[model samples]
Target: MRRLLVGLIVAVLTVTGLLALRAELMTVEVEQPEGSYTEVLVAADVVRENADVRAEMTHGLVSTCRLLVNADVVEQSFRAVGDGVFAFRLRPGLDEFDRRELRGCLSDLRVQHLRVHVRHLQTVTPADDDRRRDGTPAAGRR
Candidate 1:
């Protein structure tokens, strides 16, 4: 009987030790162009304690422009210029394009060393009265 109890305690200790070895985890809030948000799991190392990240998409004359910031995303906004390139305020002590270019296409934006998978969107003109006739509020119209 004593041997059985010892074996059970050893098994429990092994399980507890394994669980404690797991890496730190982090949660990410992803905001899409349509103003929808989703929570994603990421490594704790991706986001620092005070690091800021900001990303937004704007509809332009020809195509959509994606404005993103790595250091202070929450504090920056990009102007939607009629042309292809966008214009943003250069923060104090920060140069233009201080953020890294997200590679592997805009749909797959990897930020803060985390893989952020974004959905591609179809740009519907705001002047399309017929589209809003269905009573569904247009995205970002409000």
Candidate 2:
């Protein structure tokens, strides 16, 4: 019995030491890519409609825009800015062609009472100071 107890204590101490060493030496590194996106504001009567129906319309709009622009929609970037106004954030800032195409697509949604009279386009880019020594934006900066 004494021998068994000694062996068990040795095993427990070995495991505890191994765990402590692992805790001291383990390192975690996460790398995030830097990129730009565009902020767009859409104004239409459908956006200000009943809250329940408005959610459905917003989802449809986001899906439609994703298909039409061939761009990734920034996650959790859709929100209502004001009465009859909603905003969307699209990855990789839209160019001139994209802007024109987006405007045309929104106009085509007239049947849903979506009349986009105000389109606010803004580009988000990392500042110079945020760049790494190699001149690219640091990881997770975007």
Candidate 3:
């Protein structure tokens, strides 16, 4: 009876291992696109209470750029939207792999140690969208 139980356990473990291997091999791998494939622009503003913290935040963004090799990740891509206010963007849509890579890289960037207040976050229309003069997206646009 003990031998039979052991054989059953071994058989179950072997089957589980084989299934895991097959699933891993079957996953579709997408190569990073040479050009824009997806895009999600985020508008944000960094809190301006102290210059020292602000500089530190800017410095930290360089690490974000380095960790993720994409040149389009936002850094100084901000513009004046109002008095004492500015707008920034966080470009997305690289792919699931890039996002996952960025998430992992952010952990190493030590963002938890930084203090920057980003408020009034909103998603802007994608650049790929061509809008008409009336503020509606152009026809037959992706």
Candidate 4:
């Protein structure tokens, strides 16, 4: 009986050790690919409509855009650059599809008075150049 109990304990310890090792080895760090820093120009009418709570409206817009693109928003990226011009950065920049979707979603706001002009401020990165040379789409594109 003693021998059987010792064998069982040994087996349990072996299993536990294997599990710990497997867990350590299997841990993965998923680094989201960085994308473009885009600036969007909001229409004056839309800004006027939300003037009372402009900051909150901006946060909501950023949150909605983040969800729509399924990408991370750069911290403190939302700010007014000029009159009715707001800028924000998204990791894993928007593809054509994402851009269209974002436009459609934003159009639904403020009874369709919202107009946004999205412009990518940064030029293509070295990684993008490599990908283009390799004939593969950039990081977030289909």
TM-score of each: 0.22, 0.54, 0.37, 0.48
C-alpha displacement of 129 in model 1, angstroms?
A: 4.3
Worst 10 residues of 1 by lDDT: 37-46
Best by lDDT: 2
* Candidate 4 deviant stretches above 4 angstroms: 1-39, 47-52, 110-142
| lDDT (C-alpha, whole model) for all candidates | 0.30, 0.63, 0.45, 0.58
Residue range 63-126, candidate 2, lDDT tens digits: 6866776667788888888876778888765554565556666656634744455467654545
Q: Which stretches of candidate 3 lie over 4 Å from their true place?
A: 1-52, 78-93, 107-112, 115-127, 131-142
* Candidate 4 residue-wise lDDT, 1-142, digit = tens: 9999999999999999999877644424343345443334443335446664554565576677669657676787777776666666666555555555565555556334344555433323447768879999765332
After superposing candidate 2, which stretches have Cα over 4 Å from the reference? 1-34, 47-52, 127-142
Which residue pairs collide, candidate 3? none
At residue 131, candidate 1 shows an lDDT of 50
Q: Mind giving the per-residue lDDT tens digits that candidate 3 earns over 28-86?
A: 43454233333222222244345445444544553464346363546565544443344
Q: Which candidate tops TM-score?
A: 2
